[model samples]
Target chain A: MRITSETVADGIREQLFTIGDIPGVLWTPAEGSGPRPLVLIGHGGGSHKKGWEVVSRAFPYVTSCGFAVAAIDAPGTGDRPEHPEIRRLVALTQEREAAGEPFWSGPEWPALNETVAAQLIPDWQTTLDALRKLDSVGDSRPVGYYGLSQGGEMGIRLVAAEPRITAAVLGLVGSDWLTETAARVTIPVEFVLQWDDEGSPRDSVMKLFDALGSAEKTLHANPGSHFRVPSFEIDSSIRFFARHLGGPGTASGS
Target chain B: MRITSETVADGIREQLFTIGDIPGVLWTPAEGSGPRPLVLIGHGGGSHKKGWEVVSRAFPYVTSCGFAVAAIDAPGTGDRPEHPEIRRLVALTQEREAAGEPFWSGPEWPALNETVAAQLIPDWQTTLDALRKLDSVGDSRPVGYYGLSQGGEMGIRLVAAEPRITAAVLGLVGSDWLTETAARVTIPVEFVLQWDDEGSPRDSVMKLFDALGSAEKTLHANPGSHFRVPSFEIDSSIRFFARHLGGPGTASGS
Candidate 1:
C-alpha cells in the first residue's frame, strides 16, 4: 500500500492511496489517531470513487461518527486506465437508452456489470486487507458498506462473499440475476427503493429485499425517480450505521 | 371537558378526563405549561384509551419532545357502554380465527369496523375540538395523529376528514375500504408495514401505501408480525414528529 497524497479540511483528513494497481481514497477524523469503525462506500455506475454520492456519505461518517470511510474507483472509472470491453458494453447500453428503449433488458447491461464486478470485488477485498493493517483502521473495529444503484448491485455480491461486513445500506438496483446472491446476505440491512424508479421498478426492488436471508432487514421506500432519492435518507443512514457499528467513543467491535 | 383524575410521575403529568361521554387521558411534560404540539393517539381494536401501545408512544412524545399526547376510548370500548352489534361482529370474527380461517375476508370484519367508526369518528372530532380549547393544548399549535391496526382503520378516515392534522404515523392496517380515504390524506406521513403480518399481508399494506396522496410519505417495512413492530420505530417516530410538528421550546406554529 502506498499513500500518494494527503489533505486536511473541515475536521477531516483525506488520504489518496494505492494498493497494487487499484487506487482509492480514505477519510478519517482529522483529530483522531486510533482504530475506529470503518464504512466503505461504493459509487454508482459511471461515477468515480469521489462522486457526490460517495463523498456525501463519507463526510458524515467521518465527522459525525468519527469513523474511517473509503471509496475506490472501479476498473474503468476515475483515475483507472480504460478497458476496451467495458467501454464497448457501456456504449451499447447507452445506445439503447438514447433510443428510448429499455437498456437493462439487453445482454450488454449484465455483461457490463459482470465485467466490472469481476475486477472491483477482488479489488475491494484487497483494499480491505490493506486498510485493516493501518493504525487508524485496525481489524478490531466493525465494518459497514453503503451503496446504491450500481453500487447496490455490486454490494450484494460483495457483502455475500465477504465476512468482515456486519451491516449494509443497499438498494436501488433490482437485477433478477442477483436473487441467489442476495439470499446469501445474512447481515442486518437497510434497503432503499425509489417508488417511481424507471430502471428499477418498485416491485423488482421489493423482490430483492424479500430475497435477503437476513433476520433484520428494513426497506425504506420514497417517492421520486432513481436519482431523486430524498436527502432525509442520508440522515436515516447515519442513524442506521450508528446503531449497528457504534460511534467513535462507544464500544464497537472486539 | 372534565378532569376526573390527575397524577404526575416520571416527569410526565397524566390527566384522565371525560369530554361528554368519551373517556380519555392526556399526558404532558410536568416541567412546562401553556400551548405546545399535540399528538392524538387512537387505540387498536379491543384496546382502550390507555392501552399499552398508546401509553408507550405517548410517554415518549411527552418526555422526549415535551409535546402533549392524548388518547380517547372508541365507542363500545374502555369506559363506554357495550354495543350489542359490535359484540356480535367481534364474536363472529373471533370464531373465524378459532377455526383457522381468514376473518378479514368475511363481511363481519368490515361491519365491525363500520360499527365502531360510526360513533367514534364524530366523538374524536368533538374531543379534538374540546382538547384544543384547553389552556395547555391551545388551538394555535400544530397537531399530529398516531394509530395502527384498528386505530389505523379509523385514523385514515379521521385524518382524511380533519384538515387540522399536519402529520401522522399510521400503519398495521390494510382495509380495502379505506383506500379512497387514504388518498385524501395529503399531509406528510410515516407509514409502517410489518412484512410477515398474518392479518395484513405485505402486498395489501403496500397497496394502501401506494394509494396515499401525500407527496412526502415514506414506507418503512420491517420483517416482523403485525404486533412486532420493532422498538426502534418508536424512536424514529419521535424524530418524525419533532421534524414536522416542532418540539417544545422550538418555534412551532403561530
Candidate 2:
C-alpha cells in the first residue's frame, strides 16, 4: 500500500489546468480536510483523455477513500498548446538516437529521452505542481503516482525526476529508459502487469520492477494477452491503493 | 465445464451462410457434439463483417469446444446482403406491439422487437442450421446463445422464441423491453454488467437480468461507467470464448 487510512478523506479537485500549455482534467477533494495525496493519469500511445474513461472511473476508489485524481492529456495528443519543446528535442535527437545501440535505435520520433525529459517532463511537472494548489483540495500535496501502458511509463518518469511524487502504481510499463529511470526512484511502487502484454514481455518489465530502490515494491501479474488477460482491470488496482494510498475517512499523506 | 477432458473428440466444419442471402460465417463441431452449445456473435451497431474480428479469432474456441459459432450481419451491417431487412421488419411489427415493446421497438432501423426476433434471432438460427450440414462438425444442435448490448437482447429473444439455445451470456443488454414481453426468460444465464454504462444505466440492465425465469444463473459485476463497463473489447470476448467454448479439439455429441 502506498498511502494509508490517513490519506483517504481530503483530496479531490474538480478543476483542470494546461501544463506545457496542455489541457488536463484535475480532480481534487473537499477543503480543510487534510494533506491529501494527488494522482496524475497518463494515456497510451493511441489514447486520449476519453481513453482514460475507465481509469478515471476508478477515481472514486481513490476519492471516496480520500485522494485527488488528475487525468492528464500528454502534450502531442491533447488540445495543449503546440509547444515545440519536445518536438524540437525529438527532432534534434532523431539522427543521433537512431544511430545508437539496438535498445535505443528505434524509428526516431519528434522527441527522444533527453528531449522529452527536458521538454515534456517539465510540462508534466507543471501539471503536478498545479494539482498542489487546488483551493478546495487539502494541501494540494500528493503521496503517489499511477498510470497504465504508456501512461505507466510517464508515471515512472514523473517519480524518477520529481521528488514530490513519493510512491506509485505502474502497470504495463515496458522496460525502457523510462523504467530504467524508475530504478532510481526510492518510492514504494506496485506494478500490475499482464502476460498478454507481448509488447515487452514481463521479463522486461520485471527488470524495472526489480531495479526500483524501494524494498516495499510488489508485483501483481495476471494472465491473458494485453487485451483481455486480466479479469480485473484498473478497478482491482484501486483496491491495492486502499492498502497504500489511504482509505475512507483518513487524510491521505501527501 | 460442460465439456471436459472426459468428453469425446469430434471435428466440426467452419460453415458460411448469409442473412437473406448475405454472406455470413458459421462453424459446427462433429456429431458426438450433442445437444451442442450455440453462441451467435452480434456486431456493434455501426460495426460490420470485418468488425467480426472477435468472431474470427474465436472460431477455434467454438469448433474445438463442441460449440456452434455462427456470425451473421444484421440487416445493412457486415457482409450480409444489404437490403430492407431493418426497415421491412419495423413496418411489420409496430402495428401489433408497442413501438417500445420487444420485436416492436429500439434502434431497429425500421423497428425494435421485430428485428430482435425476426431478423436478428432468425438469421442467427440460419447460421446455426448452416453449421449442422458441415461434414466435420456432425452434431447439429443448439444449446446456448450470446450477445453484446443490442445483441444481448437478441440473445434473450432466441431463448424465448427458439427452443434451441438453452443458455446465454449477455453483456450490457439494454433494457426497456420488460413492458412489452414480461421480460421473463427460462434459460440458464449469466450477466456481466457495467454499473455506469453510458449506453444504458446499470439499473435498466439489472432489471432485465432480474427478470430471467429463475433458472441457474450467475451475474458478474465490474466497476467503471457505461462505455468501459462491458468488460474487455471484441478481442477480450474472443478470449472469453476460449475459456468457455472449449478448445480447438472440440468433440461433438449430437
Candidate 3:
C-alpha cells in the first residue's frame, strides 16, 4: 500500500492511498496513533470513494467514534482507469433510461453489476489486507461495512464472502439475485429501506432484509424516494456500529 | 388529581395518582422541578399502568432525558374496578386459546378492544388534563405518547383525537378498524414492529405503518416474536423522543 497524499482537517486525518491499481481513501482521528475499529464504506453507483454519502458517514465515524473509515473506488470509478465492459453496460442502461424506459428491467443492469463485482470484490479484499497492516487500523479490531443502493448490492455479496466483516449497515438495493448471498450473512446487520424508493421497491428491499441470516438484524424504513433517505438514519447507523464495534471511549475499544 | 403515594428510586421520582375514578402513575427526574416534556406511556393488553413494559420505558424517559413520564390503567386493568363485559370477553378469548384455536379470529377480540377503547380513551384525556395542572408538569411543555400492542390500539385513537400530543412511538398493532384512525395522526412517529410476532403479523403491522399520515414517520422492524423486541430499541426510542420532544438538557426543553 502506498499513501500518495495526506491531509488533516477538523480533527480527522485523510489519506489518499493506492494498493496496486486500486485507489482508496482512509480517515481516522487526527490525534490517535494505535489501532481502532475500522468501517469500510462502499459508494453508490456513479459515485466514488470521496462522494458525499461516503464522506458524511466517514466524518462521524472518525470524529465521534474515533474509528478508522475507508472507501475505495470500484473497478471503473473515482481515480481507477475505465474498464470497457463496465462503460458499455452503463451506457446501455443510461440510453434505455433516456428513452423513457425502465433501465433496471433490462439485462444490462445486472450485467453491469456483475462485471463491477468481478473486479471490485477482489480489490476490496486486497485493500482490507493492506488496511489491517497499518498501525492505525490493525487486524485486532472489529470490522464493519456500510453501504446503500449499489453499495448495498455489492455489500451483501462481500459481507457474505468476507469473514473479517463482523457487522454491517446495508440497504437500498434489493435485487432478487442477492437473496441467497444475503442468507450467508450471519453477522449483526442493520438494514435500511426507503418506503417509496422508485428504483428499489419496498417489497423487494424487505425480501432482502428477510433473507439475511443474521440473528441480530434490524430494518429501518422511512417514507422517501430512492435518494431521499432521512438524516436521522445516519445517527442511527453510528449507534448501531457503536453498539456492535464499540466506540473509542467505550470498554470495547481503546 | 390526587397523589396516593410517592417514592424516589434510582434518581427517578414515582407518584401514584388518581384523577376522578382513573388510577395512574407518573415518573420524573428526582433532582429537577418545573415543566419538562411529558411522555404518556400506554401499557399492553392484560397489563396495567405499572406493568414492566410501562415502567421500563418510563424510567429511561425520566432518568435519561429528564422528561416527565406517565401511564394509566386501562378500563379493566390495574387498580380500576373490573367491568363484567370486559371480564366476560377476556374469559371467552382465554377459553378459545386453551382450546388451541386462534382467539383473535373471533369477534370477541375486536369487541374486547372496542369495549376498552370506549372508556380508556376518555380516561386518558381526563388524566392528561389533570396532570398538566401540576406545578412540575405545566400545560406549556410538549407531550409525547409511547405504547405498543393494546396500547398502540388505544394510542392510535388518542393521538388522532388529541391535538395536544406532538409526537408518538406506536406499533405492534394492526387492527383493521384502526386504519382510518392512524391516518388522522400527523405528528412524527417512530413505529416498531416485531418480526415473527405471533399476535401481530408483519404485513399487517407494515400496512398500518403505510396508512399513517405523518410525513416524518419511520418504522423499525426487528426479527423476534411479539414479546421479544430487542433492548436496543429502547435506546432508539430515547433518541427518538429526545429528538422530537427535546431532551431536558437540550435547547428544545428546559
Candidate 4:
C-alpha cells in the first residue's frame, strides 16, 4: 500500500494511493482517535475512483458518524489503463450513439460488458485486501460497500464473494446477468431501483430484487430515470449503513 | 455412417443413422438418382431433431428441387442426453414462466443459453463430417444451413468455423453475444428478421444484420411476431437454398 499523495482539509484526511498498479483513494476522519468502521464506494462505468466526489462529500457526514471511506476505479475506468477490447467497444458505442443509433443493446454489448465486469470483481477484491492494512483500519472492522450502475452490477459479485462485506447499498442495477450471483448473496442489502429506467426495464429490476437471497434486504425504488436518483433515497441509504455499522464503529487494530 | 433404419414415406427416402455417437437422419427424393445438393438443418433450444418435422414437410419440396436435407439433434436435445445444468435451467425457466413471469430476460438466461450454444457448434460440425461421407452425400458438396432462434445463434459459429458451409439461412434471431462469430462469417447469407418481434427488438436485430461480414447478404424483414413468421418467407428461404445448392451444384468430390 503506497500513498502517492495526502491532504487534510476541514478535519478530513484524504489520500491518493496505489496497491501495486491499481490507483485508489482513501478518506478517513482526520480527528479520529482510533480505528473506525470502513465503507468502500464503487463508481459506475467509465468513471474513476474520484467519480464519487459529490458522493464523497456525503462521506464527511459518514466520517462524522465515525467511519472511513475508500474507492478504486474499475478496470478501463479512472486512472487504470484502458483495456484494448473495452476501448474498442467504447469507441464503437460512441460512434453509434453519434449517428442516432442504439448502443447498449447492440450486438456486441453483452459480451463486452461481461468481459469488463469479469475484470472488476478481482480488481475490487485486491483493493479491499490492501485497504484493510491502512492506518486506523483493522481486520475485524465491519466493512460495507456502496456503488451504483456498473458498481452496483459488479458489487453483487463482490459482496457475495467477500465475506468481509457485511452490508451493501447497490443502486441503479438489475440482476439480469447475475441471477446466480444474486442468489448467493446472504449479506444485508439495500438495493435501489429506478422505476422508469430505460436501460433496465422495470419488471426486470423488480425481478432482480426478488432474486436476492439475503434474508435482510430492502428495496428503495424511486420513480425516476436511471440517472436521477432521488436525494432522499440517498439519505435513506446512509441511514441504512449507519444502522448496520454505527455501534462500536472502530477498526480493530488501530 | 451406418443406416440403422431406412423407410420410404410419401416418395421421400428417410434414413436414420449414427455417425459414432451422434444420431441423425437424411431425407432425399425417393425416386432420384445420382447425388444431389445437401442442406443441413439445425433445431432450436429445447427442441429435438424431430422439431424439424414442419420444416421437413417443406424439405420434401426441397428434395423435389434436387437437394438432400438432413438434421441432427443439438446438444441436450433429441437423442443427445439433456445436459444436467441445462435441464435445471429449463425447469427454472418453466417454473418462472408458469408463474406469469419472464424467463428469457432473467439472470440465468444468458449463461444458460451460452452454455448450450457453445456445445452446439462442435456438435453440428461433427455431424456435418459424418453426413458428408454417406452414399448420396459427397465431401465436396456445397452445403447450406437453416436454423432459427438457438440454432441461428449457434449457426453463426458453425458457418464461421466450418468453411464447407457455402451459404446459410439464419432466421428469426438477433445477433447479440455472438457478434464476434457473426463477423467471421464471410459466406453468402440470407438472414430473416421480424419487424415486431417481441423476443428480439428490431433495432438490435438490425444491428446484428449490419454486423455480418458477408459480402453478399440479404435481409428479409416482415412484420410479424417472433413465432408467426409468414409462410411466404419460408418459401423464399427454400428458393434461396435451391439457387445456392441446386442443379449444377455438384459436390467438389462427386
Model 4 spans > 4 angstroms off: A52-58, A96-102, A248-254, B1-254
- Per-prediction fnat: 0.97, 0.00, 1.00, 0.00
Off by over 4 Å in 2: A1-13, A29-35, A82-114, A140-142, A178-180, A229-233, A248-254, B1-254
DockQ of each: 0.92, 0.02, 0.96, 0.01
Full-model lDDT, candidate 2: 0.55
lDDT of 1 by residue, A88-207 (tens): 999999999999998897999999999999999999999999999998898888999999999999999999999999999999999999999999999999999999999998889999
- Candidate 3 runs further than 4 Å off: A249-254, B249-254
Residue B140, candidate 1: C-alpha displacement in angstroms: 2.1
Question: Candidate 3 has what TM-score?
Answer: 0.97
Q: Write down the DockQ of candidate 4.
A: 0.01
What order do candidates take by DockQ, descending? 3, 1, 2, 4
Candidate 4 lDDT over B1-254, as tens digits, reads: 77889988766778888777677888776764555667788777767776753355346545546577888877677787757888888888778777887666676677777777677777778887777776576665688888777768777878989998998988566757777778898887877766568777766765676678886666655545777665644655676676677662443221
| lDDT per residue as tens, model 2, B7-29 | 22335454444435656655555
Error of 3 at B25 (Å): 0.5
Which candidate, 1 or 3, has the higher TM-score?
3
Candidate 2 C-alpha error for residue B198, in Å: 50
Pitting candidate 1 against candidate 4, the one with the higher TM-score is 1
Instruction: Compose the digit string of candidate 2's lDDT tens values, residues A141-160.
Output: 44566676766766777778
| Candidate 2 fraction of reference contacts recovered | 0.00
CA error at residue A32 for candidate 2, angstroms = 9.2
In candidate 1, how many Å is residue A45 off?
A: 0.5
